[model samples]
Target: ARPRVGYYYTGKTGGTLFNEHMKKLTVQEFQSIPVVINDSASVYDAICTMFLEDVGTLFVVKQDSILIGIVSRKDLLRASMGKQDLESVPVSIIMTRMPNITTCKQEDPILEVAHKLISKQIDGVPVVRERTVNDQTVHEVIGRITKTNITKAFVHLAKDELHD
Candidate 1:
């Protein structure tokens, strides 16, 4: 007697099933709502926001929520240990400024963002979209993709496999 085997997904064209296809999942599937802070906000403000949101990273934005920078736990720690006063030091001075911040779109593959997180040695990336206003283009943050989210998705996939 032969053992029975269950298939995950079967396409109409009889394409590959399971087969590492989970990498095809898009960022929109797993991304979480972003925690944003204004560029002019104080370093103390950034620290408080991080604790309140329980997030490792914060996207720095301008008026209208246009992304201008990114701040991390490491940045805040370094700033706090420095000579500047945390209550008076602005986040813009410590954040990774524009043109250097890495971002992804909603339709981007989650696998791609995961690779970027590893390669760039960062904890997360802001999910952004371009908007046109009066003939000018700007990037507005919509969500955030983080290592924790990826791990959660991986666990979900493993659970599915076990049940199958």
Candidate 2:
């Protein structure tokens, strides 16, 4: 059966809320989980894993899970072409620092996120949260949201609406 259009509108409206009422509607509802690496991990390893995972970017995090930097496929490829020794070089040496990284929260509006992706020319955003656990600082990684996910969600919602 064809999907219902009103259902899609209702879903979109519900997904647009940025406050506590914003429910986790789908994988698109949350930021994409940042693919991460350690500071000491080899650049070659980082590149290989990212390719295996089929992701374009990876986040470099400390042992404590504090976000440190990001590395993109382009960055890795560029580094590979340079004098840098991928097997010996650490990800920290090639990563883009935190000052340049863009992130989002789980409660953020999906539409706003879509705009950010377009304006920033980024494929995805990392979802993060800060919380205290046992009197220590902790970062909680919730999930990942991507442009493909958004498009698929839109199409599914549209089809569902047409049927209704």
Candidate 3:
């Protein structure tokens, strides 16, 4: 294994290179635009926004894009079946509140986010940045990582093989 000649196999294979490339992929490189809704919005509004955005999940936030909660399609479906009028109800009532929400930063590995999406059995996760608001820690919604984003990254990763 001594470096005696040029172009000698260093014992690294294509698959190994691919694995290394995948591990280095970060969430910022593959995340999509975050879909958000005001915490005060109604369930009806949430449903409308979901449809309009064509996204599976929505981040609920306050005035400054500070993440307050998250809402999924399943949550909206359940809320619709409730006896209360959708307009009269606030989305905050159905959203999975902060401190309980699963979030990732821009620098997080895409593979890690993919693992989270699979193990958590969720549709998406918001990419956030932490900030201090009145000495209180809050997350700012920046982007989103979803199964679709992961799939795109996978496609891009395998693009080199397409030429062969």
Candidate 4:
């Protein structure tokens, strides 16, 4: 039989080493409530919704809440600067549509989501789940994973370790 190993300070038990635990954290544990908007909504309404919800990103969904696109503060700002009237312009004109929207599932590792946010240079990503409704498949936006959430989790982990 092999000899048993006791607790050893291998420089992996605290502080930055806490990141190991964070990497294994599931997205479901850190994902925040998703603020959604309809694809057909006007840019004016979308902006208002963003302000009311206090979110920088909005997940655009169909009438059935099927994920279709994503809109960010930058998109709104650009559209607002255009000559076109915000009340008359639909979000579909500026929203990043499906197939291009980066997403993470609830079961995805938080580190993976964090890498995606960093690699894509985005503020947030929608957390979705594939579901079949009326025999049609759709990605349903259930929550959101953002850089803020990841940072918050990391800080929380470090603080907990320090206290221990």
Candidate 5:
């Protein structure tokens, strides 16, 4: 049987504290940081930087702080192989649009986030916060959670469990 996506929502408040603590530790302690690219950025430039940074994904965003899409390394490679000129093609053209992307909130439990990665067959999730300011809803990206983070957390838990 395939690994089941664990629904480990350990409540919102406690999850926040846990995520904060993870962030305070080394970058490796937390999940991989979400790489970002402007929607207007040239595909060539974005892909070049992504390769230089050694990251697998990039979150495409608009000027107004709205998430537009996600571009993975595979997506970039596929686009590059196509007939479109990299210099003229924008990331937006090849990005996975908003409604099709999966995301998580900072307050979600690390375990739950891990399950999401498994169930969705994704490597990571973007964290976002929705705020109602002046009666207008605004979404702001807070952080990212990934498979690496969950694995670290599980290792820590396993060690503690063994000790007990």
Candidate 6:
């Protein structure tokens, strides 16, 4: 094939093709099991869980894993500095509650999830599924999407591409 003087074909480089394939991927394809804590749990318990699980964030849930809020390591540290007893302070008091939390669904595009993480300045977002509880829409924490997960996905894609 020869290029005509005035002809142009849309250029598609490996980067462009990679971007397209990445966009088609979904959160569920790379999400990790969500580390969770009960909303009723104390701040002390949340800290313990964070260390025990080696996770920076914890999805706060209520009955049947219904998501209500999220707690981070910083939240626990701040609470620990308060005059109040850590064991007496519920995680709900220190968590970022619903209507304030960022979330994603299993079917959401991976590209969108990555953008949310970057724009929100958060390490992770809960991967949830919607449910009707008492006629109210609620989210159930099923998984989590983190920067590490996205990096792993990118590495895996690149590795596979190299082999191809």
Best TM-score among the predictions, by candidate number: 3
Q: Per-residue lDDT of 1-164 in model 4, one digit per residue for the tens?
A: 43467655665656566667667788998899999999889999999999999999999999767899999999999999889999999998899999999999999988898889889999999998899988977898899988899998788777866786
Please provide, for model 2 over 84-109, each residue's C-alpha lDDT reduced to its tens digit, 9 standing for 90 to 100: 67899988988888658777777666
Which model scores highest in lDDT? 3
Where does candidate 2 have its weakest 10-residue lDDT segment? 18-27
Candidates in descending TM-score order? 3, 6, 4, 1, 2, 5
Q: Give the TM-score of candidate 6.
A: 0.88
Q: Which is the better candidate, 4 or 6, if ranked by lDDT? A: 6
- Which stretches of candidate 6 lie above 4 Å from their native place? 1-13
lDDT of 3 by residue, 51-130 (tens): 99999899999998999999999999999987999998999999999889899999998999999999999989999999
- TM-score per candidate: 0.86, 0.73, 0.91, 0.86, 0.72, 0.88
lDDT of 5 by residue, 1-164 (tens): 43468555555686686676544443234555567878899999889878887777788877655677888888889998999889999888888887788887765666677777899898877777677767966566556676667778877865744674
Q: Who is ahead in lDDT, 2 or 6? A: 6
Instruction: Please give the lDDT score at residue 79 for candidate 5.
Output: 91
lDDT at position 107, candidate 5: 54
lDDT comparing candidate 5 with the true structure: 0.74
- RMSD (CA, angstroms), candidate 6: 3.5
Selected candidate, larger lDDT, 3 vs 4:
3
For each candidate, the alpha-carbon lDDT, in order, equals: 0.90, 0.72, 0.92, 0.89, 0.74, 0.90
- Shift of residue 21 alpha carbon in model 5, Å: 15
Higher-ranked by lDDT: 1 or 3: 3
Query: Which candidate would rank higher by TM-score, 2 or 5?
Result: 2
lDDT tens digits by residue: candidate 1, 52-162: 999999999999889999999999998988888899989998899888999999999888998899999999999999999889888999999999988987887788778
